[model samples]
Target: MQSIERPIIALDFPDASTTRHFLAKFGPDAHLFVKIGMELFYNAGPDIVREVRAAGHDVFLDLKLHDIPHTVEMGMRSIARLGVAMTTTHISGGSEMLQAARAGLDAGNNTRPLLLGITQLTSTSEAQMHSEQHIAGSLAADVVHRAQLAAAAGCDGVVCSALEATDILTATDKEFLRITPGIRPANAATGDQVRVVTPAQARKLHSSGIVVGRPITQSSNPVAAYTAIKQAWNLKG
Candidate 1:
């Protein structure tokens, strides 16, 4: 696989038509990622997956699946058929669920999707951790522990905050991929994302990929925003 210098533009668009329109603006040579999340997946289903893949852009299916082992296994089997490049599941679902997902992907005998275990959402905060989720321990420590569990469960990678990237890298193997989301360029609005970092910072920390959504998607010129990010990252390299 070619090394991507820029952050992956995860188009968390609402529906299929919007996604199609956004993708149409970019030519075949454009280096970007199309992230299919719950909103679009719920509306358009696997057809959108085909559309994105047919356009020759890598797709990251961010379904964030969390269920029992049997159900997760079945779901992963179905997801594998779509030929997605990467997919996510919640680490909170435990080791059995993660192992089952891995087994299902292996059974498909297709190009296996890079299974990324989501440690914690960027939208979550310390207060929410204790008050809402009732999770114990400091927020950062909890995230690190969950990331370790994900790795032990045989996940290919983990979706963690850029703030925790260095810690995760230290805890896991050097080759272990860390997909960090909630990335915002300097001076950009953080939006709902609580923990954030600039693209250059994430690259310096050895993050495998960065998932960027609204900062690029909601820009006046989406392609320009993406191009700027790419340029910044390339310059860093």
Candidate 2:
């Protein structure tokens, strides 16, 4: 949390080939923090993680693991062996599950990756959460609650919306990380994201890290786009 770089790019490609090609565009010596979420990981497996790491970037394997305690613990063991820098499990899975996830990381017999719990997805709006999930609290409150639970359970950090970063940072110790997704540049469209913030805004909220997707991947010059966004984050962070 003290010295983390901003703008962890989501490598949301369809397959291993496309992911490889995308990484190639960044050229050699482009060592940024990258996210290998469900899509690419499911399609490409551990090799994608290895490929990315071999190129000198840090990998955040975003599986968002959720299941029985034993099940999740074993799953985390496997994910940990991949040597990723971070991973996610749903905070809704409860404290037992979160503790088990951390145990899994310890059992790996390798360098443990940071375990970040998912507070809420950026795609889910307040109305959707109320109507579909039957949650009554405001989004920010729920996110803070989830983050607090994660901290109590020994998690290193949590993945939350930048909107909740201010409250979460205030609520928890500065060492606890708040890795925010749903980040868009000031000029970028919201796309499918409902809870969104710009890199500068997230920085202002004291976000530990920001995740950017299409804005960089879809750009003609992804490297340039990523550089600009990272620069924006630097201004406030």
Candidate 3:
């Protein structure tokens, strides 16, 4: 069995107050790996990241930046100063942009965060990709191709679904990080996600890490919900 890392809880709350209230549920001793997405970051700004990190939790700043090489390089340089545990860029940005993003991280921080490249969003279906993006071939193949690009560009990993994690890992390297989102626990609602899997399913699929949202965040008891999902993710085969 592949060693599953700690589950990253998505802090999908609207503002800093709500985010603080939610994180407080885990108590003072709790140390979590939390995701700060675009919505929250746009509302709360980088101070939210600082606040979360000050509380001893690790942050995955999910900006999903996609831009020209120079622009992305500058963006990553600024983000690196936040001292996040991980951050993301779009693999579609191509190798030059990916490499530029890496150079930015190297220039900015002494201890650089793990840079992950986004392959295909979990919300996007194969049909959607075919009709809208006009990308040929299977979505899995595209994801693997992007993962290869990410690896070659010096990225630490790629953000892919559990459905394609093993294939991407096989195509790239076994040690390549496959941080999967769209993780729904057993019997949980799938929400807007199209390529979804349960926590246990993600583990079985050899996902290196998972990003869980609503199930844990919207639950009546957030800490208990988080614990349950983490347990499910860590369950041995």
Per-residue lDDT over 185-204 for candidate 3, one digit per residue giving the tens place of the 0 to 100 score? 88899999999999899988
How well does candidate 3 score on lDDT at residue 5?
68
- Give the clashing pairs for model 3: none
Where's the lowest-lDDT run of ten residues in candidate 1? 1-10
User: lDDT of candidate 1 vs native?
Assistant: 0.84
Q: What value does the lDDT take at residue 155 in candidate 3?
A: 96
Clashes of each: 0, 0, 0
> Each candidate's root-mean-square deviation in Å?
1.7, 1.1, 1.3
Tell me the tens digit of each residue's lDDT in model 1 across 84-202: 88898999999999999888887776799989899989889989999999988888899889989999998988888878888888888766778888888899998889988888888
Residue 87, model 1: lDDT of 92
For all candidates in order, the CA lDDT equals: 0.84, 0.91, 0.92
